[model samples]
Target: MGDLGRQLAYWDGAGAAKTFTHPVEHEWLAGVSRAARVLDYGCGYGRVMASLADHGFTELAGVDLAPALVARGRALRPDLAFDVLTDPPAVPRPDGSYDLVLLFAVLTCVPSAAAQRELIAETARLLAPGGLLYVSDLLLQEDERNRARYAAYADAHGTPYGVFETSDGAVCRHHSIDELRSLLGGFELVRERRVEVATMNGHGAQGVQLLVRAR
Candidate 1:
């Protein structure tokens, strides 16, 4: 399976129709108007988008690289738009179109730092002048054994620090705060908070959530 396929497989184990909620994410969403155009980039099965809709967010759309996830999302919310991207790293949105672009848990799955930076640039391009970019990702937190495993992977393959393979054989990266800041330099920092929770994909780690505006 390709990266997208692997991601679909990973989420498949978690079930097709599942919804996730976060207190911090909900608090942030409280300020968003229902009329705002929102794009949930990397939206797996439209969980967050559904949550936004529940919070009365209209004009919401979602895009995912995994076709299966997109299909599932469509099945769950046929009234809402859900697109499957055939092209990797390409969002089929015009420049300065969206008021909010969410990148929750996306960067971690992208193992290459260069690709991550490029994706951020694309996201910036898609945002309106005052648009918001919300990001939540895995923070660099590893136990002793996990740290050694990450180190061994980096040493063996010369991968970047924090880049390692998950138990499912999928590659993911954990980011330090400084690294996150540098990668997100194209945007103006609004707010950032640390969330200590394991991901739904079965990986247990701390995460950092960021809210930024288009520069």
Candidate 2:
């Protein structure tokens, strides 16, 4: 199993249910028109997809790296579209297709900077002109425990400070705002705000949310 596959297995065994939502997500999603086609990348268990449906979005779909999560999402929201990616990452959508693409809490899971860049580039390719890309991820905070953990990873693997292991045996990346902005250079940043949200990994840490537009 790949890193994401292992993490997905952990989520499946641990009950992958998203119970929290950041206020920034609501604020950004409010801009999506009712007829807009939305794609929720890394959407686990269709929680956000269902929420979008409730918000009156007519066209909704999601893709996940975890089969169990995708199955759970399909079971939960049969009306919404769901697909599980193969070994290599693929979204299975036409280029410039969606009006909105969500990348909530996804980049943090990917350990490779190259993989993260490729994912972001693929997301950009999926968006139509003037489409929106919404991202929320763990921010590199000043917490002593997390800092110590990150340092240990750096010492052991010679990796960067942002990648660390969570209490639930899952690895995640905590990106600096500058790093995120540089990686998302293809998109035009329309709005960005730091929001404190619950941690997806078992380790509880503060997070940052970003909203951008495809250029």
Candidate 3:
């Protein structure tokens, strides 16, 4: 597994400049009640939470591992709640505390499979039974540039096939469809969609959006 300390350090520093571009599909969330308790896990700058609040979601909270990012989020959306996650893979909230959880672009930031699974397990713990988990993340790209980077980085760092280092020094990982589904095994897939989104560094990439119900 990649060192969590290094990852956190990168985000605490250079991550402040990153602009998350994952689009939160309002249609996918239309069925959810406005009163539903929503938690945006790994929410950098509270962009998704702000969008949800604009759409009438009354209960919303966001948390991120990077203190700087969480501080930026609080400044950007003072009306919504934002907190720095003091513990990794374990949210401070009680089990079943949320009716919905958003995991946007978070899996990519976490380069270790075990850490990603632990994060998902925590998401499940936070969600009430039958609650929804909305995830948006990068998929392994077939392009030569990406393939070469993935191969080189994996070879150099002894990480997984899709793991790579960003130009700005952050470690990130893309996921295979099977790998992602395996991580969400505790949930029943409700809907999925493929879309092109700009990377935090502003490169176009293939990404997947998923809505799953907690079992």
Task: TM-score winner between 1 and 3, please give it.
Answer: 3
Model 2 scores a C-alpha lDDT of 0.79
In model 1, pairs of residues that clash are: none
| Candidate 3 TM-score, true structure as reference | 0.97
Q: Judged by lDDT relative to the true structure, which candidate is superior, 1 or 2?
A: 2
Quick one: ranking by lDDT, best first? 3, 2, 1
TM-score of 1: 0.88
TM-score of each: 0.88, 0.89, 0.97
Per-candidate alpha-carbon RMSD to the true structure = 2.9, 2.3, 1.3
lDDT of 1 by residue, 117-212 (tens): 778888888899989999988888768856876798899889888887766556778888999999988789988898876665545668889999
Once superposed on the true structure, which residue ranges of model 1 sit more than 4 Å away at CA? 1-24, 201-203
Please write out the lDDT profile of model 3 over residues 21-80, one tens digit for every residue: 899899998999999999999888999999999999999999888899988988888899
- What range of 10 consecutive residues in model 2 has the weakest lDDT sum? 15-24
Give the deviation of candidate 2 from the true structure as CA RMSD: 2.3
Candidate 3 has its poorest 10 consecutive residues by lDDT at: 1-10
Number of the candidate with higher TM-score, 1 or 2: 2
Query: Candidate 1, which ten residues in sequence have the lowest lDDT sum?
Result: 14-23
